[model samples]
Target chain A: MSSQPGTVRVPQEERTRAMRARLLEATVECLVERGFSGTSTTLVSERAGVSRGAQLHHFPTKNALVVAAVEHLTEVRGAELEKAAAALPTGRRRTRAVLQMLADHFTSPVFTAALELWVAARTDETLLAAVAPLEQRVGRQTHRLTVELLGADESRPGVRELVQATLDLVRGLGLANTITDDARRRRRILDQWAVALDDALADDDLQGETA
Target chain B: MSSQPGTVRVPQEERTRAMRARLLEATVECLVERGFSGTSTTLVSERAGVSRGAQLHHFPTKNALVVAAVEHLTEVRGAELEKAAAALPTGRRRTRAVLQMLADHFTSPVFTAALELWVAARTDETLLAAVAPLEQRVGRQTHRLTVELLGADESRPGVRELVQATLDLVRGLGLANTITDDARRRRRILDQWAVALDDALADDDLQGETA
Candidate 1:
C-alpha cells in the first residue's frame, strides 16, 4: 500500500467521484427546501454528510457546485428523455410520446429545482455559462422534432411558430401547475394542449405553401 | 396641555392606515430582492426603516405581510388596467389595450416577484388562502373579456376553447419572454397572439365565418 501510495490510486479517484455525486445530490435537496439564493455551501456540506473541508476539496466554491449541479441535472434529464423516446414506437407514437414527456418532465420536482437554479443563475456567471448550452440543446431538439413531425424544414408555414408556441405552452403549464393543485383546472389546461396539437397536426397547409 | 392631549386624542384608525401603507410598500421591496422564501419579517422591518415592534403592530405576522402585499399589488395592477381600458376608443381597442397590459405587467419585476410568491404559496396555507381569490378574479376578468370579445358565451361551438386557447397564448408568451431576451423572438410570439385576437374578433360563427 505504501508503494502504491506514490502512484495515483483508483480508490481515491472513486472516492472523489462519490463525493462529487453526494454534493450534487445535496445541492438538489437544499435547492428544493431553501431555493437557489437561500442555499449556502455550509448547509449543503452538512446535508451531504461531508465535512466542510471535504466539500471544499471537491467543490472549492458555491459557483462550482452550482455549475456541477446544473450539469448533473441536464444529464439526468437527457437520460430520461432518451428513455422516453426509446420506449415509444417510431413516427406519430414518438411525437405523442415526446409531448407526454414534456408534460411529465415539466412538472417533476427535479425540473422545478433546476428551473429555480437557472433563474437564480441569471446573475451568476459560472451557472450562466452552464445554462446557455442547455438552452441551445432545448431549442435544437425542438427544431429537430418539428422537422420530423411536420415533414418539412423551416420554410413550412407556421411550423416554426407552432412549435415555439407549443414550447411556450409547456413552460407556462409547468409554472402554473406547480403553483396550483386544482386537478380539474390542470387537466382542462392539458386537454386543451392535446386538442391544439391534434388540430395543428390535422391541418393541411391551410396557410398555403411557403416559398 | 395635558388636558388638550386627552381632548385631541385622534382616532386609532389613522395610525393603523399609515402603518399598513408603509408595511405594504416595504413588502414589495423585500419580495423583489429576496423573493418569497428568502423574505423575513426582520429583513422587511429593516427595509421599512421601522422597529420590529412596529411591524408586528401593523401586520402581526409574515403571512399577513404577504397577504397585504398581494392585495396592494392587485390594487396597483387594477388601476393600470383601468387606465389602459379607459384610453381605448372602442371594444376592439379595449381588447387590444388589455392584451398590451397583460404583456407589460407579466414582464415587470413586481409581477415576477408576485409569481415567485404565488409558487411558494402552493404548499403554504397562508399564501394559498391569500392567492385563491386573486386567481378567481383573474378567471372572472378573462370570462368577462371573452364575453365582450367573442360576442357570445362558452356554450357556442368551439368558442370556449378559442377563448381558453387565446388566454393560454398570452400566458405562454409571458413565460417565454421572461427567460429569453430575444426581441425578434418576442415579436414573433406577440404577433401570434395578435393574430389569435384578430381571428376571434373577425369570426362571427365558427361554421360560416371566414378569416
Candidate 2:
C-alpha cells in the first residue's frame, strides 16, 4: 500500500484552512440570519459542523471570530468585485454599469452581515475598537476601486466628492433594502445618479481640455 | 385659593403626557447610548426618573415601549424639521441649506435610535412589523418635504429619482457618522450633491422651456 500526494490523506495545513473557512462562512451566515446578538460560538460551531474544540482552537472568542469572519468575507467580496469589474461594459454605458455593480455589492449578504456588526459595534467599546479600523480599510479600498472602475480623475474640483457621494448613495440604498425590497426605487435612483455622474465627469474633461 | 388653570395644580392629563414624553425621550437616549440589545425597560424607567409602576402602566412590554418611544421622537423631530425648513434661505443657497438640514436630521440622536431599531428589526419579525410602516411614513414625508423644499417638479424626467437619491445619500452619510464623526467628508459629499441637484433641476427647466 502506498500513499500518493493526491490520495485520501489531506495535508494538515489544508485541513486546518478548510475548517477555518467553514467556520468563517458559518459565522457570516449566522450574522446575516440572526444578527450580532443572536450569533454565538456554539451556534457557529454547530452550523459549521465543526467540533467545539476545533472552533475554539480556530477562534478563541466570539469577538475574534466575528471580526475575523467579517474581514475574511469582505476580502472575498472585494475579490469578487474586482472580477466583476473586469466584465463590465465599456463606453457610455460604463457609468451605469459601474453604479449597478456597486449597488449589487452593497446589497449582498456580506454587506448585510457587516451592517449587523456595525450597529452592534456602535455601543460595544471593544467591538468598536476592532471594527472601526476594519471599516476604514474596507471603505478606502471600495473608494479606490470605484475611482479606478469609473476612471474618475480626483484632480478635478468636485470629482473626488462625487465619487464619495456615489459610494454613500449605494450604501444608503443597501440600508433601505434591508427592511424592504427597494430594488425598483434603487434602480431609478442609480439611473439618475449615473447621468449626474457623467455630466460631472464631462465638465471635468472640459476643464482639463481648457487647462 | 381656588384652583387656577395656570397655578400649582397640573392637570392629570398634562402630567400623564409629560411623564410619557419623559419616558420616550429617555428611551431614545438609551437606544442611542446603549444599542438595542443593551436597552431595557428597567433602565429606561430609571433614566426617565419615572416609577416602574408608571413605566409598566404606560408601556407593558419592551417592544411596545421602544416602538412608542421612537414614534414619539420621530414626530417631534419631524416637527423640528418643518420648523427649520421655514427658515431656509430662499435663494441660490437654498439647495445647499436643504441638504444640510437633512444631513443634520439624519445624524441626530433620534435617527441614531431609529437606526438601532432598523438593524435589530432585520432579524426580528415582531419588530419588523412594527417598524416597517413607521419607516415608510417617515421616508415618504422626508421625500415629499425635499421635493417641496427644492420646488422640484415631479413631472420632469428624473426629478423624483434625484430627490430620492438625495435622501439615500444623506442617510448613508448618517450611517458613516455612526462609526466616526465623518463630518468633513459628509460636508464635501453634500456640497457635491448640491451642485449635481441644481444642474439636474436646471436641465428640467430647460426642457420645460423647449416644451
Candidate 3:
C-alpha cells in the first residue's frame, strides 16, 4: 500500500493514530469482558492484534491504556448526548427528551466499563489516581450538559437541585440495572420522574405559558 | 470460660455461628478493598483469622463464601430498613423520612460491597449466577418496603412508579458517590427530590392533613 501511487507518501501519523485507536478499543473490550484485575496490557494488545512493543509505545503502561479508553468512551458518549440534545425541540418536549437520555445514558457499555474501573480503583491506588480525575472530568461535563438540557434555572430555590437530581436518579437506575434486567421497571420509573420533573418546573412552564 | 458452671457446655452450634459470622465480615472487607478477582477463600480465611478447614467446612467453595457474604449483608440491610421504617411517624413526615433513608441506605458499606460483587459478576459466570438471584431477591424486598414507606397507592395511576423512582434516584446518587465525593450535590438532589415526592403525594398527604 505504501508503494501505491495514492499512498506513495508515508502515513506514519495515520498509522500511529490507527494503532492507538485499536489499542484503546481493545482495552475497552477487555475491561468490559473482564473486570479490572483481569485486564492487562498484554491481553489488550493480543486482542487488538497489536504487538507488545507497539502497545508499549502507544501506552507506556496498562493504566495509561485503561485511562485513555475510559476517556475515549466518555468523549463518544458526550458527543452522542450533545447531538441528541441539539436535535430536541427546546421546551417541555426538550426537557423530557433530555431526561429520557439521562435515564438511558448510564445503562450502556460505557457505564459498565466505567463501573469496572471504579470498583477496581477502590483497592488500587495507582488505578484510582488514574481513574479519579477522568471520572470527575466526565461527571462535571455531564452535569453541565444536563443543566443545559433541563434549561433549569439554578437561581430558583430548588430548580438546580431538581436538575441534578435527574442525573443522580438516572445513575441509580443504571446501577440497579447492572444487577437486574428490569428495564421495564426502569422505564416506568423514568416516566414517573418525568412527571415529577415536569411538575418541578411547573412554575417556569406556567410563566412561559402566560407570557 | 467453657469450664464455668452453665458455660461448661460446649455449644458447637454457637461456635459455628461465630466462625461463620467472622468469615462473612471478612469477606465484605476483602470485597470492598480488593474487588472480585482479588478476593479469595484463602484471603478471606486469613482476614477472618479462621483456619482454612473451618472456612471450607463452613462455605465449601469461594462462590459459596462470596454469595453467602452478600446474602448476609442483604439480610442485615433489609432488617435495618425495616427498623428504620417502623420507627418513622405514620404520616406525611414518614414519607420524607423514607426518602431520606433511601438516599442514605445505598451510600453505605453494604452498597460498596455489593458494587464489587455486581462488577465481579459481570465477568464470572459462576459468580453471576450466585449474585443475580441474590440481587433480585434484595431488589424485590427493597421495592416492597419502599412502596410501604412511600405510603404510595400503587392502585393510583403513576404512584407506584413514583415510589420506585425514589429508590432508583437514590441508587444513582450512591453510584456517583462511589467515584466522587460530592455529598453536597447529593444532599441537594435529595432535597429537590423530596419536594417532588411531596408533590407527587400531595393528595394522600391531604387525607392525613385532617389527622
- Which of the numbered candidates is closest to the native, going by highest TM-score? 2
Question: Where's the lowest-lDDT run of ten residues in candidate 1 chain B?
Answer: B200-209
User: Least lDDT summed over 10 consecutive residues: which range in candidate 2 chain A?
Assistant: A202-211
Q: Write the per-residue lDDT of candidate 1 for residues A42-148, one digit (tens) a residue.
A: 99999888999989877888877866775686667767776766566665445545556666766676666766765655445567677667666765775575456
Superposed model 2: Cα runs more than 4 Å off: A1-10, A204-211, B1-10, B205-211
Give lDDT tens digits, candidate 2, residues B45-67.
Answer: 99999999999998998989999
Clashing pairs in 2: none
Choose 2 or 3, whichever is better by TM-score.
Answer: 2
lDDT of 2 at A60: 95
Residue pairs clashing, model 1? none
Tens digit of lDDT per residue, candidate 3, span A1-211?
6468556444766888788888888898898888777899989999999999988987989888888998887888889988887787775566657777877788888888888888777788998898998888887898888877776667667776777778777777877777668688877777667766777776553211333
Candidate 3: which pairs clash?
Answer: A169-B169, A171-B172, A172-B171, A172-B172
- Which candidate model has the greater DockQ, 1 or 2? 2
Instruction: Give the Cα error of residue B16 in candidate 1, in Å.
Output: 5.1
lDDT of 1: 0.64
Q: Please provide, for model 3 over B1-211, each residue's C-alpha lDDT reduced to its tens digit, 9 standing for 90 to 100.
A: 7457466455766888888989998998888777777889999999999999988888999889988998898798888888888788776566657777887788887888888888778788888988998888887799898887776677666777777778777887887788677678777677667667878666443211233
Question: lDDT: which is higher, 2 or 3?
Answer: 2
DockQ values for all predictions? 0.27, 0.62, 0.52
